[model samples]
Target: MSLKGVELQIAIPKTFDAGKMADQHHQKTINQQLDANEALNREIERKQLAVNKSEGMDAISEEDENDASNNGQTSSEQNKKKKQQQEQDAQHPFKGNLFDFSG
Candidate 1:
């Protein structure tokens, strides 16, 4: 018998671990679900922030309008006070004509 013509045969058994595969599949599904939930939460927070920003802008505009109206009223009241002062000055021309030098 020559060494080049000699051959050896060996038997090896193949096995499948079903439980380990199932556990791996289950963990993959759980990770996917967690990722989806995180994405959904981020979307909800973004929409809520947008709504709050819009509401804040609306409140600021309303306050500006009220301030404008109040300013108009204040100007009218100032005009009335000036007219009253002018009438009083006309009635008593010498009331404030002399300055008090004693102070």
Candidate 2:
């Protein structure tokens, strides 16, 4: 017996596109990252505004304090003490001389 000719056929099912799935996942991650960055920027701007408003008030208070200190008697006794300390500091700015400073 001899099998001279035969017709054989094989079919393989198509596989899913792994690369397309990966691309979709990447796009989703990028969108999420962009949203996070925008939110962070908004928060930073809000914090800067708060800091500026507070610093402005602080500067005004310091200016008022400076004006109050021009006279001999200050608005608070603490200011008087600070003035006395400043005068003492002007006379002897450092407890030890520069030659005696280790650091």
Candidate 3:
């Protein structure tokens, strides 16, 4: 209600609920923790696989390091290492969510 031509503004605050705010904060923290744990798990798994492969290659049927020597040098080791390096270089240097539109 206005008296004459003067108007009055109310100072009432907006209907803010304290419980919902706390719940939202809790959910945000949980999500962040979950994301961090997932990243840690993936990194651990990758490292484990690398360790296993290195250990498991010991008994494999491959040219011995000493057998591939030439003039006290190993040509076979060099060639094999070079080939593996090439394969590694051929791998996309990027990890996760790679998209190549230049087909």
Candidate 1: where are CA atoms >4 Å away? Answer: 1-16, 52-103
TM-score of each: 0.40, 0.39, 0.37
Clashing pairs in model 1, backbone N/Cα/C closer than 3 A: none
lDDT string for model 3 (1-103, tens) is: 5434222222222223456687899999999999999999999998877745464476343436434443465778677876896687578766755789899
Alpha carbon lDDT of each predicted model: 0.70, 0.70, 0.66
- Model 1, span 1-103: residue lDDT tens: 4323223221111123566678899999999999999999999998877755467787678757756666757767867865886686478656757888899
- What shift in Å separates residue 53 of candidate 1 from its native position after superposition? 7.2
How well does candidate 1 match the true structure, expressed as C-alpha RMSD? 17.1
Candidate 2: residue pairs that collide: none
* Candidate 3 C-alpha RMSD relative to the actual structure: 13.0
Candidate 2 local lDDT, 1-103, one digit each (tens):
5433342121111123566678899999999999999999999998877745456787679757867776666468667776886787588655556664477
Judged by whole-model lDDT over C-alpha atoms, candidate 3 comes out at: 0.66
Winner on lDDT between 2 and 3 is 2
